[model samples]
Target: MSPRQTLTSLIVGLVLPSMAAVAAGKCERLVVTGSPDAPPYLWRDPQDPKHLMGANADLLKEAATQMGVKVELLFAGKRSQALEEVRSGRMDLLADTPLNTGELESLDFIHPPIAQNEIMVWTRVGHAQPFNSLAELSGHAGAMSEKTRVTPTFENTIKEHLTLAKQPNLTQAFQQLMLGQAEFVLAGRYAGLALTQTLGMSKDLQAQPLPVDTPGLYLALSFNSACNDPWLRGQLAKKMTELAASGRSSEAVARNLELWKAQLQQPASTPNQ
Candidate 1:
């Protein structure tokens, strides 16, 4: 080789290994999970039982795509189990986590929450009474899904003045309200709407206009994850900020609501396939 070609080849040989190492160290893929029953936010994909499909899943996937990272949103059983998986470092990310003191210790929450959820009261249609605030329901009996978590203040209020029952799921909570067993059911507005529509109970239930609590839903990374590096966290936070500003996160909810409706209309797939 000529002297000039030899010099260029030597330079290339020295730089390529360093570049490859850096690329290899970067996080290329993340394993993510979340609540398997929250429709329009997250739920198991009927067609693909191993994965989840919905608004939060879509938003997370889009954000990761923009960051040139592949994300696998999986069905990790119940919401509690999903959180545990992330907490144990078995999963890299929790897609739609709500801020709570208990979770902060085991997970690093990405800033600029991806979505805000309104916790609302649902009462049977025609049975609704004035509910301008949570205080108005103080003396009333309420039902909530067993997995639902409320603010500390709300929990105190329940302990002090409210009579609340925890049901196995939101459907049971709503059923209690419908049967007049409970005066109201506390649930996320979109989730309640999705359930009502799917169960053909839309005409029977109404959500109070006033939200009891508005909680921001965040993306959480397990501290033990190999990919839990500053670059990965910062990139995710930046993408989430952009998504929040573009209003696409809200749009994702609306879009997935329709998607959920369409999916439910299809005939049920046979089990044990």
Candidate 2:
């Protein structure tokens, strides 16, 4: 064969496959939904109404980039609305959800936990401890969100003492506690600390780390969505593990905590009010 013809054939062979691979990787934009109530976990920035930039938001943004996907944040009015969006295929990802049997039919959860949350009790600065043991919460009044899940003994015991309220979000739960409507409230340590600071209640409330329970938080994808992309999930999982191993994730968490502390020191102004 002539040298020019040989070179032309080789170029076509390489370019055609490259073009095919690029087309295959192209994905439709995805929407991630969460309520504005969960501050520092999944809350909107007051300064940027369209932007969500908390610890969980940062983590998910990193994960999506690593997975080669484009995502937009959809702030639901309530947690139930967010869940409904996911179930109906209106949303793609739901970060930081606990494993719930009811959701399994419509959702496929990622395997390893993206994060773990230490459930703790928050009370007024000088209030007596709500319960000495997980068993002790059986009869007392405590506030927990309708969507929160308490595992094992704590779950069963708290069921009786719980007062299900229509606060609809974590921010409202904190408000309920502040208004003396509930004896105690349950929240993740990192999340609760950040929210308390954001709400300017650090001096008015105290977080007492309880040994009641801890739950692994996972990333959830809707089964009904066209983008049920496990390959993307795998990429994100690997990147997250790398971030955790290199201590970058921890550093980010610490930096966010310091930022929250500084926010707490500022004069109180409600971000979403």
Best by TM-score: 1
* Tens-digit per-residue lDDT, 196-255, candidate 2: 777788898777756457776667889877777656666667766776576655555666
lDDT of 1 by residue, 32-67 (tens): 999887777888898898999889899999988988
In terms of lDDT, model 1 sits at: 0.85
Top model by lDDT, which number?
1
Q: Please give the TM-score that candidate 2 achieves against the real structure.
A: 0.71
For each candidate in turn, the TM-score is 0.87, 0.71
Backbone clash count for every predicted candidate, in the order shown: 0, 0
Q: What lDDT does model 2 reach?
A: 0.68
- Pairs with backbone N, CA or C atoms under 3 Å apart (clashes), candidate 1: none
How much is the lDDT of residue 37 in candidate 1? 74
